[model samples]
Target: MEQAFAQNLMQAAQAVEQQVDDELNRLEKLTESDIEKMRNQRLETMKQEHKKRQEWLANEKLTESDIEKMRNQRLETMKQEHKKRQEWLANGHGEYEDLPSEKELFDITKKSERIVCHFYRESTMRCKIVDKHLEALARKHIEAKFVKLSVDRAPFITERLNIKTLPTIALLIDNIVKDKIIGFTDLGNHDDFSTDVLEWRLGVGGVIDYKGDLSSPPDNNERKKKITVFGKKPKTIRNGMGGDDDDDDNDAED
Candidate 1:
């Protein structure tokens, strides 16, 4: 009986040791799995942060390129403006050798002779076209003097004339502005432009007579005729009535 009891106690001790060994193995597996899960989570977070940084760098590069492009464009525009200014200054500061001054312009009008003034922003294609017409008119009317002025060089004259558009023409007689026409026109349209200039000369009444053989003789009967008989007055005639009597009255008043 003593031996049997001792054997049973030994068997109980072996069973308890086996149970403790199994529990320790299960705990080791759980701890390894948890550690692996934590490592995977940390790696994923690092990848996400790296991706975000790369995207931010790409956006910053794009923004910098856009800013550089705008700066280049503005610099190019400034260069063009400077070139234009230099050209204007090189051309005698906007005054021609025989060109009349503001006071001289007024004197030309007072003399009853018509003064043709051409205002240009620059020597552009449109200005060249207008200049050709002016040369033709100078040949056609010896009594009229053709004057050229550049707006870029003569800001005071441009401002005094209230010239807002490029390639403007003004007809002055006896220092009074009789008519002004604006814009460029085809050579085919020169007849209309010439007509405006002629009308301004006629506003002087008796100061300068048309000397061209092509000019018709002035008839007192024609002078009594209505303006409708001679087609419509040009839209450029802002002031003045179209009659020799009106001119006489104005002269008398002066």
Candidate 2:
């Protein structure tokens, strides 16, 4: 009877140990779940804080006085820079050394058969527009070359071209004058003049109004007609020699 009682006690101990292990596993799982929840809550709180900070920054206002002060500061900075540049240029500083010379400009103009030279004054709207269009025009017509000469930068070219306008566009073929247009109007009008200049240079006669693809070769007949130089034709040898001298002599002998 005492042995059987000891056996029962061993069974009870085993059952207690199993219950303890099960409870420990459940507690650990609960602890991990709580930690995960806390981490997510912390992340959400940080996101909310960031959003609030961005909103506050967006709502922040700058008064007229603040804006005026900022503008004044910028203007002062610009003035100082302008003064420094002027001083550097006046003192023959090497910073402004690589500017294009008159001789270089002349050489470039002479080398190009179909050359488009632009003369423009400094800080002008027409000048800016011309500057922008020059490269595009050059690319569109590879046969033509585009060059920019500033009235302020190259005074000699400006004087030589006799540029009285703010933006002067000169088209030359073989160093000979083809056509010239001055000033920049509205986009519509400016495009008209640009088209006119290009068409004339390409020997397209009058302005080509059609906006079809320019990559295709122009009409052969139209090209011939436009390029043909109008002048008196040379007299034929037969006409000049009075209808073949040998035939005339044989007829006279007969």
Number of the top candidate by lDDT? 1
Per-residue accuracy of model 1 over 1-254 as CA lDDT, tens digit each: 99999999999999999999998887677777787988999999999999999999977777777988989999999999787655534432223223544454444444334566777745456666667656665554445556676666666665655666656666666555565555532112343345434433333332234543222212323444343213233233333212111111111000
Q: List TM-scores for all candidates, in order.
A: 0.37, 0.36
The number of clashing residue pairs in each candidate reads 5, 0
* Candidate 1 accuracy as TM-score: 0.37
Residue 84 local lDDT, model 2: 63
Backbone clashes (count) for model 1: 5
| Model 2 lDDT on a 0 to 1 scale | 0.51
User: Model 2, residue 154: displacement in angstroms?
Assistant: 2.6
Query: How do the residues 18-118 of candidate 2 rate in per-residue lDDT, one tens digit apiece?
Result: 99999899767777778799899999999999999998876577678887998999999999978865553443332111225546555654544455666
As a whole number from 0 to 100, the lDDT of residue 119 in candidate 1 is: 74
- Candidate 2 regions exceeding 4 Å error are 1-99, 185-254
